[model samples]
Target: MSIPTGRQILRLYRDLLRYGRQLQFTDKNYFARRIREEFKQAKNTEKVEDINFYFQRGLALLKNKRVV
Candidate 1:
């Protein structure tokens, strides 16, 4: 699998920050750890048509306020 770019990773990180902000009960640090775990998993997977798909999924989860 191809290594993900810094920009893509940063996008995912940005979404995570936004997601953390939306939470009322959970600590931001916990939410960030969750996002980081998911990113690590995605980076270990096989290559796909678009690298940004992972970030898109994360952003969608943030938009819906749902965990992976």
Candidate 2:
């Protein structure tokens, strides 16, 4: 598997942030902070497979949220 480039990771992060804004939660700040924290924790990850898994998992979770 090819290593993901910096741009790809950045794009995924941005997309997650954007999608996170659509979450229908009472505490928007808390939700946003959680998302930021999750991404930040993975910032230094070096494995491409692990990164891809996280990206997909994050996207799935965001997609599952109801936009109320």
Candidate 3:
């Protein structure tokens, strides 16, 4: 898969940030651990073409931010 653009990555990162913030009052470790585990599972797949998709998507979603 192609590398995501800075804007795309930023967008994804923002999503993760929001999710993290939402979970802050709860169990932050659990949220982080789940994300980690999901990534790990994605890594195990044998399809080379799709290997980066999961990471790229995650990064993109986590990085998005609204300019104030």
Ordered by lDDT, highest first, the candidates read: 2, 1, 3
After superposition, which runs of candidate 2 have C-alpha atoms over 4 Å from their true positions? Answer: 66-68
lDDT of each candidate versus the true structure: 0.71, 0.72, 0.57
Please write out the lDDT profile of model 1 over residues 1-68, one tens digit for every residue: 56456786786687677768778877878887877787777776665645557756766776777665
lDDT winner between 2 and 3, please give it: 2
Candidate with the larger lDDT of 1 and 2: 2
Please provide, for model 2 over 1-68, each residue's C-alpha lDDT reduced to its tens digit, 9 standing for 90 to 100.
56666787677678766776765754667767877898889888888788888777765766775433
User: Cα RMSD (Å) per model?
Assistant: 4.1, 3.2, 6.9
Question: What tens digits encode model 3's per-residue C-alpha lDDT throughout 8-68?
Answer: 5445545665676665355767766766676567645666456467655565554563111
Worst 10 residues of 1 by lDDT: 43-52
Candidate 3, run of 10 with poorest lDDT: 59-68
TM-score for model 1? 0.57
Best by TM-score: 2
RMSD of candidate 3 to true structure, Å: 6.9
In model 2, the Cα lDDT at residue 66 comes to 48
